[model samples]
Target chain A: MSASPGVWLAAIFTLAIYSFLYGDNPVYKFSEHLFVGLGAAHMAVMGWESMFNRAWTPLYTKGEWWWSGAIIGGIMLLTRWFRPIQWISRIPLGFMMGVAAGLSARSAIDSQFWRQIQSTVTMKLNTTNNIVYVVIVVCTLAYFLFAFNEKSGLGQGIKGVGLVGQYMMMIAFGASLGSTIMARLSLVIGRLDFLFKTWLGVLK
Target chain B: MKILRSSVPIWLGVFGGSIVLLAMFIKIPVHVGLWSKWFLEWRVILASFALTLGAGNLLRIHANRIRMKREAWMYSYVTIVALIGYTVLGILFKRTHPVYSFIFDNAYSPLSATVFSINAFYISSACYRAFRARNGHAAVLLLSGVIVMLGSVGIGYAIWPGFNTMTQWIMNYPNSAAMRGMNIGAALGIIGVSLRVIFGLERGHLGGE
Candidate 1:
């Protein structure tokens, strides 16, 4: 029912992608390649905009010499394409990695480790559900302990705890899988809704 | 050349990482904080360059394939044309152009959504093969999965009101516990690896010796 060119284009591409469900074919291949091309171009455009806004704009307009370092680092990254000057790329790579490592390590310590442990330990285990949660958490942590010798008494106890942890994790994974399937199914439904309602006018 | 090739990078990493790490804990004069902020910005700029590099690499590979007339070479032409065409359009008219927006909304958005939607079928087939209740653990996992899936939909409510309650309990308690445990383990691993990289003990990123 829709005469819009955009709607028509979308319908064709959507059907082409869905065609993969039957089997690999030229229609699917063409769509897939187009998707990759568009995706890469989008990324490059974003990168260019980011460089212009974050690095070039500051250096050019405000005369902030400090940002020149970033521009130099970015340009150095392109040297990776040239075989003779590939090693020059490592300087920027190292700088990026170092800063990332520092930031991640710091945040992981606070948010992932300390905050998580603090919250878990401080939880009031008054109810049966609360007790179960604490037990599961402790058991799951135990499962990851690889240093324990299973022959020792403490190790045997740990092994028992680890088994419970394994089961809990399996249940967790199953729940996650169910959640993922539902999310994907929702997307499929949305696509179908577009096809039926917007494109074909088959649904109210 | 040798120093530029190896030692300088290691020293730079050590200096940059140490300064950033120290700045977090030690707010030495106002300059340290400013320096750290600058470093963070530099990281973002460098990351943008990395994205561009990745795009360039993809272009190169596809261009090579087209040149060689390899299997499915015609598709490579489609890719290159689309890539170059979109990039040119974006650069010349900017992202706000009507044509650019039209292509993105109709072509890119639909393509991305359909690609992800197709995963629902694959995941269902995988679940069928893997969700067999051959043992107690498998049974537990399968039961949890079934409850969650059903409880999320209207049909499950019609089947049993208790399904929703069970789903909520599983997600809140057991799932949260497992995720917390995994997060802690992953955090420790990150700390260890990051420290190694910071100290130049992990030279793997430097590529071949």
Candidate 2:
């Protein structure tokens, strides 16, 4: 019922995608491929924009020659397709990976490892709930200890704690699953709202 | 050839990783801090290039499929045409152009949303089949999942006020505890692997022996 061409196109595309629910068909296949194409093109465009702004502009306009190294590395990355000079691509890959590794390692140690431990240890167990929370945290951590022998007395205690931890984890996973379902359903609702209200003009 | 293929890359990895890592602990030398910052920016540029390369790979695969006239080859033509056409439109007029925005808003956004929304149906079907309470653990999982799912929506509060309270308790205590424990373990694993990669002990990324 929408008069706009854009709305009409969107409805058609949405319908085309949803057609897969009925089973694989030509419309769904076409839409799937088209989606891939558009997605890839969008990525390429963003990449080009980044290269132009970050590397090209600085290298040419600002005369920052160091950025030229990035440009070279970017170009070198394309050599991955060529079997003869594919090894040349490793340099950029290595550089990128190293940077990623370094950043991740630093943040993981600082935020996840040290900060998490500090917070866990420093939590005040004044209330019953707080005490239960602390105990659950300890139990959860115990569950991850794979080095203990199950036959030993210490291991038996750990195993009992770990079972409680396992149950807590299951409950957590359930909550997570429930949250994901709700989120996905919200998207579905949004699409349905668009189809009915925007496209069909059925709802006020 | 050996150096280019192996040794040089390993050395570059070490240099790149070490400079960034060292800069975190060492703030005295101004140049080291500057280089570390520059390296991070360079990574963005490199990642952009990687994205473009991925697009190129997509093009190659589709073009090859079309040439070979394989199964569902007609779809390949659709992909190729859309990819080339959209890329040209975006490059020529830039992203802010009305035509580009129209295509993105109408085609891309709707398509993406619909694709994700489709998962709702599949997930519901899966839950119906898999959410049977076979044991105490299973019963707890099912009950928690049901409570949370109901409490999140308007109908659950209407049904029972206690649902919301129970949902909050499960999320605050057990959920938080489990996630924190998992996060700690994962962090340690990440640190170990990252250190290995930085030191060139992990050569999997280099591709092939």
Candidate 3:
């Protein structure tokens, strides 16, 4: 079956955008704004859609009485426009913050602290890999004990530990950077290939 | 007297904020009010305005760079040209139709992705340098790194079953614990900051005199 008009149009447009990889051109800029404007428009429409489907229709047509509370809360979110009434907007902000805080507090306990200690304490030493984990944990922890002076025994120990942590962090950062670059290159290649093979039919 | 002057705004902010919080739990059988909906929508509008301001700032900075003929002025020129070109095209075509779609899939997508793809080589080099065993703690880290790395590839399975198990243990246990603790602290801190803002105790964001 042949491709639909919409599909062909989208494919051609995609190629137009891909032409940008060679250098800065008019086509690339056009694509960039198209993405931004579409993104903004989509978000605005989504917000309105949610409010209509969730609040308006339910309350007006179906007579879902409880929706009034949501409508009130949502309206309160708009009070920031009037300088005199701006403080009224804080009502929803407070509720959002409170809920967010509670959720984060519970999640944090399970994910960050307890799990870290559990892993550190039950570490393996027999295998080469386990040995590295054990060392990293110890050294990284040691590096953080900065209460002591550099010349003193305790100070020197903590400093040494911090240095190890620093090294590990640097390594991680470098790896992250490399991955980012590779990702970018792949995108460029992908775009180029799409333009040439799909739209122009120059290469298969 | 001075504290009261500063505290009035804080009290109002806090009071309004608290009411909103209370509203969430009170299922009064009545539909949620229009006030909540308005508040959310208003925030989106305000946020959009702020985004426009940010874009303006970016443009201004680049324009200045070109005018002054600063180092890498050509790059600034390219940025300005690109920004204007895209903005104009979006306005002119005025639709997500074919003409507009062509620019998006080919240009912006590639730029964002190409910049991100260059990190793989940098990561490999970084990893090699980091895995060196200098001390007891360093040694443990080195060991964990190797295990995790090997486990990620098929080699760990061929080498030893224990390597994969150990790597999983490290990630599941210690890594998670540390991450969780940090997350908890961050949540608490966020709540505190939010409360302060609600109460107007934190006026720093407002840029007060």
Assess the local accuracy of residue A121 in candidate 2 as a C-alpha lDDT between 0 and 100.
Answer: 87
lDDT of 3 at A95: 45
Give the CA lDDT, 0 to 100, for residue A177 in model 3: 36
Clashing pairs in 2: none
Per residue, candidate 3 scores C-alpha lDDT tens digits across B15-90 of 4454444445555633333444433443343344334434556667867977898865556655565555655555
Q: Model 3: number of clashes? A: 101
Provide the lowest-lDDT 10-residue window in model 2 chain B: B125-134
Superposition error at A183 for model 1 (Å): 2.4
Question: Per-residue lDDT tens digits of candidate 2, residues A1-204?
Answer: 899999999999999999999999999999999999999999889989989998899899999999988999988998988999988999999988898899999899889999988988888889887787888778788888889899999999999999998888888888988878988888899999999999999998
TM-score of model number 2: 0.95
What is the DockQ of the complex in model 2? Answer: 0.76
Q: Candidate 1 residues A1-204, lDDT tens each?
A: 999999999999999999989999999999999999999888788888888987899899999999998999999999999998888999988888888888888888889999999989888989999899999988988898888789999999999999999999989988988777888888789999999999999999
Q: Chain A TM-score for each candidate, in the given order? A: 0.94, 0.93, 0.73
lDDT of 2 by residue, B65-157 (tens): 988988999899889999999999998999999999999999999999999999999988877655688888888788888999988888999
Worst 10 residues of 3 chain A by lDDT: A170-179
Q: Candidate 1: which docking quality band? A: medium
* Residue B146 error, candidate 2, Å: 1.4
